[model samples]
Target chain A: MLEPGQIADLTEQLDTDDAVAIIEDLEEHEQKAVLAEMEPEERAAVESALTYEEETAGRIMQRDMVAVPEHMNIGDLIDYLRKNDDLPTEFWEIYVVDPAHRPVGTCQLSWILRAARDIAVSDVMKREQTLIPVDMDQEEVALRFQKYNLISAAVVNEDGRLIGMITVDDILHIVEDEASEDVLLLSGAGEGDINEPIRDSYKARVRWLVANLATALVASFVISIFGGAIEQMVALAILMPIVASIGGNAGTQTMAVSVRALAMNELTRSNTRRIIGREFRIALLNGGTIAVLVGIGTALVFSNPMLGGVIAVAMLINIVIAGFAGIFVPVMLDRMDQDPALASSVFVTMITDTMGFLAFLSLAVGSGLVSF
Target chain B: MLEPGQIADLTEQLDTDDAVAIIEDLEEHEQKAVLAEMEPEERAAVESALTYEEETAGRIMQRDMVAVPEHMNIGDLIDYLRKNDDLPTEFWEIYVVDPAHRPVGTCQLSWILRAARDIAVSDVMKREQTLIPVDMDQEEVALRFQKYNLISAAVVNEDGRLIGMITVDDILHIVEDEASEDVLLLSGAGEGDINEPIRDSYKARVRWLVANLATALVASFVISIFGGAIEQMVALAILMPIVASIGGNAGTQTMAVSVRALAMNELTRSNTRRIIGREFRIALLNGGTIAVLVGIGTALVFSNPMLGGVIAVAMLINIVIAGFAGIFVPVMLDRMDQDPALASSVFVTMITDTMGFLAFLSLAVGSGLVSF
Candidate 1:
């Protein structure tokens, strides 16, 4: 084998997956050279999986298993087992297949070890078995594993033939990836992977920032229409952002809930109306509580009761719009086959900010509370 | 044996674990009653797991297994398995264990079927086998299963005694649950299970809204100070919100990234500096671009190039602050052992809004851009 230093040198030149693959193809000397070359973190990740395939059954399954076949004498089975290797390694059951490499049934290792071995494999194997399709999406695969509480199941291909098997380990990665993806999408950040190149990260984040700017411009244009009112009443300028800020926050909270529900398959056609109704009620309750507090505070700060009333009314109206827009925006996007989370925050912010300004300024102008 | 209908009924009233336990306890009629009461969903969940314990090996494992003792004549082993009634229906290997129920070795089904049964178990059973601890966290459990590519594994208690077994199915659920939990926590939402009660939904959402309200008030208070500037120049009021909205959105984008990174264990002390540096660079690039567009728009709308220049500088400064606060606030909170995701959003919003208003308003006053 190559010396440790040589291995470390080689490992530094390759990514973890490639290094592992190359090592597998090399002689013991070369393998050692590459492994020793790897950093501790890379080595650990690679060495931990050296025995399994890069993408196949062996790599994804535990080596611990209990196996037996169609025929055995109970006494002979026990005596043979007692005098031999230990029992109950990593295994859920024993497989019984036909002579041509086709699985017919299975028996639990517990049942076999606890029972007399005189029984034939056919006698113990359960006739009914749920076979997994190997190429299934990992999320769907995990779902099956969850629903079934399967310890280990047979993996089969399109021909109804057993191929290599997928175990719980492979599905775990799928679950984590899918969940993280949803979160990143919700924020309009492209798949937020730390390992992603700097260029990719820049490209993803900049586009969203630009979009937000565009929406902010729309809000600014709306504010321009109210320039006269603000010039007349200084308080209007100071208090206006409060309305937008409260509305934007309320919208974000509601949007978060809706997006999560949609992802979990919880908010569907049947429940949409009910969920919306519930959110509305909650919004009113939330708005009223905050309106009282902020209203009183505004009155005290500005010493203008009428100004406080206007702010209070604006807060209530904005919160209501926030709740509605939060659910409706995502749902509409989903219906259009767009990712519900994609650019949703931008749209929601636009609605809340625009409405916050329009309502507060309009109310001020309409009431003649501040004369231009 | 219980009828399918009865088994279905019983499963409806119990959680998967409880149902399995009662299945072991029920009289034939009662078992049938419980199964009959189960709806399709409940029945499917329980029936699929009839062989395993709730959390133990039995609940999560398939009952199919293969086994042979150490002493069996190879020929006799073959013959005996062909006639057995209690053997597992199917399995990948046969376990060889001691009288004390400790596993020592294994034999693959392929080797057994191909080899002469006259060979002794000692000659064929593999000595290397990985043992699994039963009480391991599901994520850890899934990792082991993936690392090992295990089809079936024996589950053991603290004493190293085999308690039950685990399979890919159980690990699948663990993976999904862990992933979903991270996603929900990032959004400050409770486990967003649809089945969760409405009251819980209410409690989970209201606190964040209130926190957001408090932050919104800070922004409002900032505006109040700029009342004189607004009273002098209507354009200042018109443009102030644009600055705040852009900064808020940019800050949110960065906050989402930081929170997600922290949750995934990707952003640790070692990488914190690198991550922060990257976000700051992106913020500057984004801030520059948005400033140019907004500045031009402001100049055109207000018919004053000087006003546009002042606001543009303010926009650039506020956005950079937003980015800094976004990454730093979460990192600091995480160090203090508070949930970074839960409170970061509110804090970031406050920073962006307050800074946006302050920067824009102060710049206008200092630059003499507003004429009373």
Candidate 2:
């Protein structure tokens, strides 16, 4: 219920982290107001982090950490921890660093709790520890966490000195974000977060729509080239879409598989030929089965056996084309360093829609079922 | 390199666990052959588990676990573990169970390693432990792993008896599989895996193509209703696709967002209206911006201001439709207990393509740019 103005006042009095929590619970207007109220300096830090794509470690990592010199004894470490009133309330391990502030080992909380008070920090600490670079992608970070069964890891700077620490909590966000992003990309949407504003959503989606529009036009233009065929035989128009629709769908299926394979590092140069060959074979099988059904259906609908034969042949051609475009388009896009999921759908649709119309209409005209 | 026949021979000589490992490394043919070679009783046990969908806890759990009586002490446990030669090579915790073999407590390996030999298991075992059900889905299992920061968890049966055990390794596979599945579904494809055989890939893709074909036919039929308009003026046909393509792409973008929101539990009954409104507004804004550009672009390309105006208006209408259909289609599918990712793309494409064609073609006919 807090108004925007009220939230703004709260930020002026509270810290950024505390303000973030408060804003999270408030209405959108209030959150905006509080954000607006912050002085540019205070606002910039939180805003800069907020500017980072959500679900990244930058968004989830805590700025605070406890570091100790490697030379400290257990007694000295205990004194330092006890004296520091602002230590993180919970931590599973404490980092031990060299004089240069680079971590050399880590001591588990349990080990520290159990060790002799007079023991040196180096004596109790385990030296073999995994270190995470600060700029490493969050997904890779999460992978490391999973691989090593880590509770927390040190985030080091370019110089390999500990700058902060990233914990399981940060990884949790990254896992969720990365998972959600894959889902969004596959669907050809911009950052599809529910929290995004209406205007932002509109802006994000419109570009893709425009792209779809261009592709759809290509399909229509292809059909236009055979307009005489459609006018000569209404049946040709009725049957034409069937070819393109089937092809488009088949292409999508292949595109989805290829995009996923590429994302998972499963589809690579070594397997590209194999995957394409597999998709082509699948398209043929599927086309053969569906073409038989659609052909029979078309023959029945039109009461013309010749018409059904033409549509069926067109269906087979379109489906094969769909399958080819589906796998190849995504694979090519991925190879070109574009996002396979983002661009593949548009390109695949263009190929399927345009080819489907051309195949069905051209076949109809060539067969004299529709005379120009 | 291991052939199916050779793997089958190896399975016969190895224990069940070893057989499972060997099968995992074999080619698909080899894996099937080995399973075929097993005795019916042994095969039934393994096959029953294989029947559970891949990535589920049922497929991932180890049938063997070390369950001890609650009465056993540190000295007794140590002696038992030492004498057991066939135990798993790695385990972090030991379960203490009741007479019925239902786990009541767990003790970490490190605790056991450091404890006095004579300490009672009951006194040292942790009473509060998270237990996962055997049938719990893999995604849920990964969530639990992240939430509790678990190293290992026990899998239980319907009656709450310990049936098997799940470790971090199993959860890792689930995380990867679930993530990949979500991505594939969003792109309108069947299960996608790099290791998947080409034949299977073909079968999975062709069905979707056929479905897409059916929908595309519907759109084409709508266009045929206005075929006279296109025949009268080729310009209408040339411009129609531009409008439709933009709309379809826009719709795809919105649809992607909606599907992701639905998947992440971000868009629910509580926020549906808000999200939809937000998306609608965003669509309108995007439509307005793109409308201006496309309108200008068409005008320049065709050298006809009226045609450009028609294209721009169609673009706006089509984009708005795309946005609405994108969110609504997924939401409706989810409500019907269907996976939003699998069928949503097909449905959304239908909406965009149909609306795109209808809007552009109808507008052209209505504007008197083409005579029917």
Candidate 3:
């Protein structure tokens, strides 16, 4: 609720990095006004941060960091730290750099605190560390932070020189965003922000619904081909949707699992085939159980065992196809460098719907339960 | 990939908290074996961590952390830290404890480093901090950490005495697991772990498919009630899946948004009505867009404007109902203290499918496009 001047004053008291987090979320004109209202030094840091593409390491990282040379002892480091009033307002680790300014090691604050005054920085610091590239996507950066359990890591530019640091707090937001983002994207609810303007929400959602409508047309086309059979036997129409519904549900289940696994990098090149086999077997068990329950129910309701058999077989076939389509579509999209969650649902549904209808009706016609 | 003995040896060099992570996942017998092989002190710490319920703050927390009294001067605290060789291996902040060992404030290492030797700990410490309950669910803990941007937090027992510490690295796994978990649960794919046993996978997936089969019966029963109309005008059958499919898609989109929003605490009682209204408007726009596309396409393809009009109106009505169901079902489930993501999809799809058929067929008969 504060005005731009108040925000600017607040930014002056905060670190440049924390200040950028606030200003970067504002509209471009608003950001400009806030920058104009801020102190020049803080304004310069905000401006430089704004130059990076949205959701990059550079954008989320704090430019102010403590990077010391490898030769500094604990006593000298503490002396230097106490002497400097202009250091980063928040930093948990120190980057130990070589002469050319590239990081050679990282020293946790605890390690420095626990060490003797005469110990060399190189001797005490961990040689192995995760270094985030400046232009790396924030999602990837978050994954690295999670994987390595990093509270803070050195952000290196193209030349491998330390430029800034990214902390755990920064990655926390992106983790929630990226994780929730998949659910939103998979469901075709773009951004899924409740605060989003109705126009924006409407635009993104309607586009997805329309794309879905086009695919539903493919299912419609399959049904239309069996119009003569449907007219002769109304039961086909009554039972066909069940097959499609079951298939759609099965496909979605598999697709959700595949999409998440791919996101986590658990379904990788080495084990894709194994995972595919695993999905196939799960589908078989699921398809069998549904076929039994649905087959008996349809048979008793219609007093026709042949009709029951056909629908049951169709359910089995369609669900198995759904399982394959679910894993394949997302894996294919991911291999093509696309977001598997974004378009996998639409494609999987189309395949399941089309196959579900085609299998049920075609079996009915071929079995002479309904003739064209 | 290493054997249990090698892992045991490797864990010997790691912190007890890290060692527990390795041992906690092993078979019970294997965990016992690994614990038996560890040094008595490390084993005691690891065994104590294992005593808490899995996925609680205590289970993930490390027993080692540095806490100092509030009145301690920076110079004295530094001397104490130098004298004490045993401290948490990885920690970013120091908790300032009261006389009774309850946390009163927190001091970051950076703050400690920048201050003069004469300053009291109270002067440099941050008074406001996020404290975690020892027995609190890990997921809730993760949410709190993400919300507050905490790298480390004090875990206090029921008496508000500091018991342990939770670090960011511990939370990262939970965050990823939780986010991926929603996707799996919503789709009725239990656990969804690629490495899960095939028998377990089959048991979980088949149960869901069978439940879906039972719901599909409700849709089938609805379609059966309108069999005569569908038989008289077979085009109705061809076009019905399109309406139902679109409704299902719309419902899913809304449900995903609402479920995720609810999970993130974005949709509270205060904003529930606003979000509901927002979704209603979105459904209107999405439904209208599909009605237009489907209507025009149906009229051109079938040469029946009345039939097209019927289908279009049906799409709009059914989708709007779907939108309502989508938001209401999850919101209600959440209010009742259920995991909305677990069962919302099934209920939403059931409503959409049954209503899609009832709306389309009822409209066709009501408008005299077909006769019962």
Candidate 4:
């Protein structure tokens, strides 16, 4: 590891935000030592940034923004900017604040350049600005930027006083990480990344496999209820997995779609019923198609039309039920304020696996193809 | 069902890019009709945007950017900007170009404001830039914006001349969409969205289920090969699915990690072996933990120590094989220029399902726990 002076020397060459990011990742004592080695102004900036928790707007916001009083003219604003050497190297917009430092509006660079020098900043500024709360999660910040097509937004503290601003450049990587997080979490792959430690990977994945064990046990218990039927008609044993496999796949498909929709905020209360209804219609089509294909194949292979009919009806029933469970599980989890992606898949799989077994075995007995 | 004139009016009230997006979503004839009703200049702009394929840099790039000759001074640039009435309402940077209109550097709005009037454009501009090709895919553009931490980048044609510019604000949505696309595709859920047409959803999901049907048959065939032993002992049928279930879950967890890594360009040829080794160790830990739990449970439930031992060995072997298949399938698919997310799951599931059944049932017979 580099010494404190060496680290401080390296960080001093970077932007204050970038410098803070590096020091924040260090151990507490090491960070303190590095901060002590820094210049007072830069040290104070880094320390202020560290006051906020990771992945929050306060942590990513730049303190180097320019905020002018709403009464200032474009000429004064331009003069202030040209005279200040401490300002950030790149900024697309400036906030117009009242006497209390509360942001009243935002003025774009082009608007400033186009307006007459004598025009008040308030006259050129747009009042409909998106303000990010200082402690907002970075993912929420990314969403706001995307939704409003923002170039830069002011970050306000609890009292609604403008503190700093976050630029779109700072948000690009956060969007990618958050979206990828949903995919990894949905698959029961906790925070999946190539650079993740092996022990961490084992811990994350084994916990999921162990959770799946309970679901597997539920499926086994369902199968054991019909163990006598399997003994009497061994062919049932050979073909039973096919129903569960297909049902699980179908459930996963719907669950993936629903989870993605939920993440993007596209599936909301107003459209919940409509989306569910749409999924059901899709389920009917998919179940019908698979039932026909499997039914014909089973009848020809086993030379037993009755058994084929039993499996066909079961396959369709399981698939449609799987679809309902898929949508319901994620939406329910989301409403409960749980991350739908994190836990939805395990529940959806459990439902499909249990239903897949119960539906097929019960149908086999009901149709007189086997006995309990 | 709005008329062409009404549609044109609605689109006219929006930004040019927004207008083009609305027009692009319409059927070709409807789009043409709407375009015909628009003012000639706006219609021409929309038509030019339509020449590029959907989801390309050309479609997303703004043609309204300002480019200036490198020798121009800051004072002249400001005068020209103030004189031009047709400039975009908002722009973060202006490209400094050569006589042939190829970008030599990029001048930020802040740089111009801070520089003295006599400072040449090239003196203040930063030469390092990320220039996007007009035909580059939108996802790739998003990646470049993210990698470079760019606020905006010039879009160049095949001739390496600046055509338009893509801003990070435009890229924010693409990052979310592309990342979400990876998750949806990996689950065999094609473009999964709640608002997607019912017919399209049905078509996408049913095709995946049918593909899964083929994989189900392979599992069923493996079970069929063990039919004699299952007939001799009903316990094999009751426990066989547990092996496949746990193995499949483990495989999916690994596959998700690998696919995300491959997508992010983190797991390249330079680090493939290291990641594979990392996954292998994780698999061992997972397999060992699961084996002990299942082995003891089976032994206590069935009162057969040898059966427990056979299952324990089989489970470990199957889980390890699953880990290999999970990484190899996606890596191999990615190397073939096919989307690893699209087909890796199907192939990995097929392998784990077959191996899970084969290893467990084969061990049962080899250990003389059941007769063929």
Best by TM-score: 4
Q: State the displacement of the C-alpha of residue B267, model 2, in Å, after optimal TM-score superposition.
A: 3.1
Using DockQ as the measure, what is the rank order of every candidate, best first? 4, 3, 2, 1
For model 4 the local lDDT of residue B210 reads 89
- All candidates: TM-score: 0.69, 0.69, 0.94, 0.95
Worst 10 residues of 1 chain A by lDDT: A57-66
TM-score, predicted candidate 2 vs. hidden true structure: 0.69
| Model 1 spans with C-alpha error above 4 angstroms | A1-141, A150-166, B1-178
Candidate 3: stretches off by over 4 Å: A1-40, B1-53
> Against the true structure, candidate 1 has what lDDT?
0.69
**lDDT by residue for model 3 (A1-372), tens:** 788899899888876667888888888888878889988878888888888888899889988899999999998998899999878777899999999999999998887777777888888899998999989988889889877888889999999999899988878888888889899999998998889898998898888898899899899999999999988999999989999988998999899989988887788999989988988998888898889888898899889999999999999999899999999999999999999999999999999999999999999998989886
Error of 1 at B228 (Å): 1.6
TM-score of the second chain, each candidate in turn, equals 0.63, 0.79, 0.90, 0.93
Residues B41-64 of candidate 4: C-alpha lDDT, one tens digit per residue: 888878898999998988988888
- Pick out the ten consecutive residues of candidate 3 chain A with the lowest summed lDDT: A12-21
Give the DockQ (2 decimals) of all models. 0.29, 0.30, 0.78, 0.81
lDDT of 1 by residue, B142-199 (tens): 5566566665566555676544445444455655665565556555556656556657
Error of 3 at B164 (Å): 1.2
* Model 2 agreement with the true structure over A1-372: per-residue lDDT tens digits: 656666676665643434454555666665566778777875765665455444354544444567889779866776676567665544557899999999999876545544555889899888999888756667667778877767678878679988667666446546666666766665556788779666665555655666766677678778778866766676665566567666766776677677766665668798788877777777788888888988898889779988888888888888889878888887788788777777777788889888877887888878887676
Question: Per-residue alpha-carbon lDDT of model 2 for B148-199, expressed as tens digits?
Answer: 7676788888899987777664565566667667667755566776567766
Q: In candidate 1 chain B, what residue range of length 10 has the lowest lDDT sum?
A: B51-60
Q: What overall lDDT goes with each candidate model?
A: 0.69, 0.72, 0.88, 0.88
lDDT of 1 by residue, A1-372 (tens): 666677666655654434554566677776666667677876765676475444443334332233344465444544555455543323345556565545677665444444455666567567677676545444445556566655556666567655444444445565556666767776666877766776787688778877887788788788788777777777877888888888887787778778767765678999999988887887788778778887898889889888888888888899889989989998999889777888678899899999998888888887779654
Tell me the interface RMSD of model 2, in angstroms.
Answer: 5.6
lDDT of 3: 0.88
Over 4 Å off, model 2: A1-176, A217-240, A287-321, A358-372, B1-134, B146-165, B227-244, B287-321, B355-372
